[model samples]
Target: MRGIRSLNHLPKRCYAAARRSEALTVPLAGIKPSSATPLPPQNVQVSKLPNGLVVASLENYSPTASVGVFVRAGSRHETVENQGVSHVLRLAANLTSKGASAFKLCRGMEALGGSLSVTSSRETMVYTADCLRDNLGTLLEHLVNVTAAQEFRPWEVSDLTPRVKIDKALAQQCPQIGVIEKLHEAAYKNALSNSLYCPDYMVDHVSSDMLQSFVKDNFTTGRMALVGLGVDHSVLRQVAEGLLSERSGAGAPVAKALYRGGELRVQNNEALVHALIASEGGVTGSAEANAFTVLQRVLGAGPHVKRGSNITSKLSQGIAKATAQPFDATAFNASYSDSGLFGVYTISQADSAGEVIKAAIAQVSGVAEGTVSEADITRAKNQVKADYLMSLESSETLLEEIGAQVLATAAYQLPDSVLQAIDAVTQDDVVKAAKKFVDGKKTMASSGHLTNTPFVDEV
Candidate 1:
């Protein structure tokens, strides 16, 4: 009887399975695909508040959003009395603010699945916050507190000394960083000569009063730009008008960066030599700067392929012929608001450093003498355009780009415009840029086994 019952149920099960398979192959009778229209893309909208704060935002409609407070209080703004204050202030971002305690600030950001970070360069300090779009309001409040409402308690500021030392120690581990810092120190007469790290004497000595005074002098509305991505422009404007308008006026006069060529060398027993030789190039956002940028790509800014030799680089080709040792060479171009540095950076075995450095500079000389072809210029322009476009694809980089431009020019140049500017660089313009670097006063910074490295004047 049990076998008979099982046999009877088997036919019904088979029928049900057949029906399910049929259902899997076909759509249901009444289901329909979505008919809603997609939203139109929004361009970056920029406006200024009555208090002189620049507000810029783009509605990318992304799930994640980012906002940054860009202030002109970089190392360049530091005075002789406040050297390394910016470095200490960068580490003090998470300290208790006027509106929130340090503990609450940390926990609030964590609860919202967000992050806040502070990064400074020679000319700017950016306080950036990232969070989901739904929780952007809460995260943005934290950013405001960090940038505008800081208390900088003495004990908390004192606690940042160890971190500052760690930063300097870690930077010491990288020869590239040391060389760059030395380059800046050697390149400028006054404003631009400041190092990004805290000096040894000022590491624990950057007092709370100093931080507060620095903020009071530099974090004014006129010197700040509030920028955001994947956000509503009006909301950003409201935040700027409401909370960020406290420091209304231009707080202090800015001193222009003066470029004076010199040299700084560090003698060490390391097996490798890192050398940078530069000349005054072009101011930021100028046509000359664009040419310098194109020239950088022509000489090869860096390897396009990861861990691959830049065989196509003129610097690499030139240096490879001069020495058989393993070496890396690339063009280095840094443009600031008032000045720029254009040069070649080379790293080679200590014994081959002189040959590598001379060869790298000789490549620039070749370009200055019209050795570069129209084809080279075209390829470099393409590279510049591609790099600029690719950088904007990331939300974080895009925010930074927008902030930098707005802070500098009080306006944004569209990508098409930027590409057009890059394309407008003629072969003659590149040659002229090369000639400027070849003829201008040079600043050199090198580390590791100076016995083989050439001096600035020698190069």
Candidate 2:
């Protein structure tokens, strides 16, 4: 007890002063927020290298920076034989690159206290590293090496087997995921229907050769973008020039996704029934899509504020009040390169699944058939814009958004422009976008206890 040290000599004011000093220490002191000055519409600088590689970067004041390379090689490019190639490639990211052992690469990242992760979507794959500004150059170099590295060792491929199996098992066990997977399948027959996850049957089929081939074919400069957040734009450009190749395949053509509305019902003993009924929504970043975005908010996702049973959307409220048993209905809108889906997902007990789905259908039909009020449209537009702006607060998400926008549209959408687009969406536009899916063959997917789940045509 005599040896025990305490800060008795330090005054309490010292702690307050330390915190105040910390708060005042800004990374970039010149950068300050001012309402009267009006911030720049788009501060992100985008440049294309001689090799046709697009480099997009956001300059800001932050201790941590997120940098990544987003490629167009995803499930859309996968063939029947290589259905899970993207998932395999995603796992292969940051593994042993040429001239760098896995240990060395991992050690290097660990030295900088960085985190590396890979995510694969329906039409893109993103490899991201979050680290300090001092580590940016090293991290960017690693991203390039990771992208172009050829060695997808058989041992690593074998290790992913259990992981792939676990992914499939987890999806099967979670009816929410199962219903969404099936909904995509039912919505689009061929191209867009490719599962984001590696399927159970295809787990054994994804090999190192297939992944390497995918990289060779799709990891091209034209099909990819190097993106950075909270990093100097000029620094990003230099890294892009030094690392990414000016040569590679332009990637396989994206298969046109034509919506074919149908029904998919999978029976599992999971007590809770999960069902999704959606119609084709809007294209990526399109006005119609933006309208649907507003409509989704207007339709309501769930309770706006937590704790209370009072839901904001008519459908949610209807489900809450109408169902004898407890249930939840959420509005969903999934977007891709060319096509989109707008629907409501409902989860309910087995005995009440049918009624819940029907109630959801009635709500959707009401939105499509009935005229929406000006106040609802105005509120939904504001909500959609707020959601988009809030998401931009994260460096990692901003990096992905920048890269994805570049890969998908070859242009950036400024936040102001997006707000203007939302502002332009009138009630008529909302109604039309809502009815677009309803007019088309409805996409119905049901999982879990199917006995109580409504059939496709029944609703």
Candidate 3:
């Protein structure tokens, strides 16, 4: 009887093993498919609230959601008396708010697997929150508190001094950062001249009152945009109207950035020299700016491949011919709402810095003299279009692009329109852009051994 029972169990086990050996692609023996329909794709929707808050969102049907509040209270808005307030404000994002304690904000986000962060530039500040689609509401509550209801306790604000110093110290480690900061300082008379990092004198001196005043002046609905990705437009609009409407009217007058070209040099003992020479180029969203974008690519905008030689870059090729010494060169283009900067950035051995700088400038001059070919123009335009499209593929970048456009123009521009603008750039346009840079007032900033670096007027 025992042997018979053993044989029966063996057969059952063999049958179960055989069933499990079926191909994964094959349907299971007893599962039914659901009849639910998938959600349709939606385009970006934008609306402006009566209070002047711009609300934009897209329902991409993604499992994760990202929302951002873009405010026009960047470092550019800092007054002479409150320089570096924006830097301190960025670090104070997680401080105790009117609605949530600092600890609660941290623990709440951790519980929901979400994150909140703040980033500021010369023109805008962005507060972004990310979480699963199901937990968006909870995340938004924290986002609102952080962006609008900040308490900015004195103790918490004081505690940020060490972090501020750390930020400056880290920036000091990179010559590129110091050069860029110095360039901005020399490029503008006001507004855009403010440094992103806290100044040494203002690191521990940014008072709570200063932060509050800056917020009151720049966080108004007139200067804010609420943007979202993988979320409903109606939901975002409701939040904009109901929660972020307290600062309804235009909060303060904005001063336009005045460009006054100049130069600043930092002498150091390093053997390598980093230099940037620029001239006024084009304003953001203009046809001239598109031309400059193409011109930048034609000259060279860094290497496309990771750790690959920039053999195709005109700057690199020209500079290589100028000297056998190891050097790096790339065209730099930055467009802002009111003004722009276009130029070349080069790093070379101290003895060859002057030659490298001159060669890079000659490359631009060659483009201005129409030495470039139609093929080069075509390639550059393609690069510009590809970069623009690829940047929007990431959700974070997409949200930022949307927020920037909406905040700047109170509207959103589709990627197709942007590509069309790039496509409209002609070879003549590229040459003209190069000519403008060659003739416009120049601003330069350089660091490292000054043994061979040319002065701005000399270059």
Cα lDDT tens digits, model 2, 1-459, are 767657796678887676754564455567776548654544888887767688888877677888888888778788888888887777677567785878888998899899889888888888888889888877777777788765888887878888787777776767787788899888887878888788778887788888877787888887888888878888887776766664344666767887889998888788888889988888888888888898888888667676755367777777877775456788889888789999888888888888898887777677788657899999898888888899988776778778888777667888888889889999888888778867767889988878877788887
The alpha-carbon deviation from the true structure for residue 40 of candidate 2, after best TM-score superposition, in angstroms, is 11
Off by over 4 Å in 2: 1-42, 306-310, 324-326
Badly placed stretches (over 4 Å) of model 3 are: 1-36
lDDT of 3 by residue, 336-410 (tens): 889999999999888888999999999999999999999999999999999999999999899999999999998
The 10 consecutive residues of candidate 1 with the worst lDDT sum are 1-10
TM-score of each: 0.93, 0.88, 0.92
User: TM-score: which is higher, 2 or 3?
Assistant: 3
Compared with the true structure, what per-residue lDDT tens digits does model 1 show for residues 1-459? 644666655666677677854655465679875679999988989998778899999998899999999999999999999999999999999999999999999999999999999999999999999999999889888998998899989999999988999999999999999999999999998888999999998888999999999999999999999999999998998899988888888888879888899999999899999999999989999999999999999999888889888989999999988786557999999999999999999999988898999999999999999999999999999999988999998888999999999999889999999999998999999999999999999999999988988888888
Score each candidate by Cα lDDT. 0.92, 0.80, 0.92
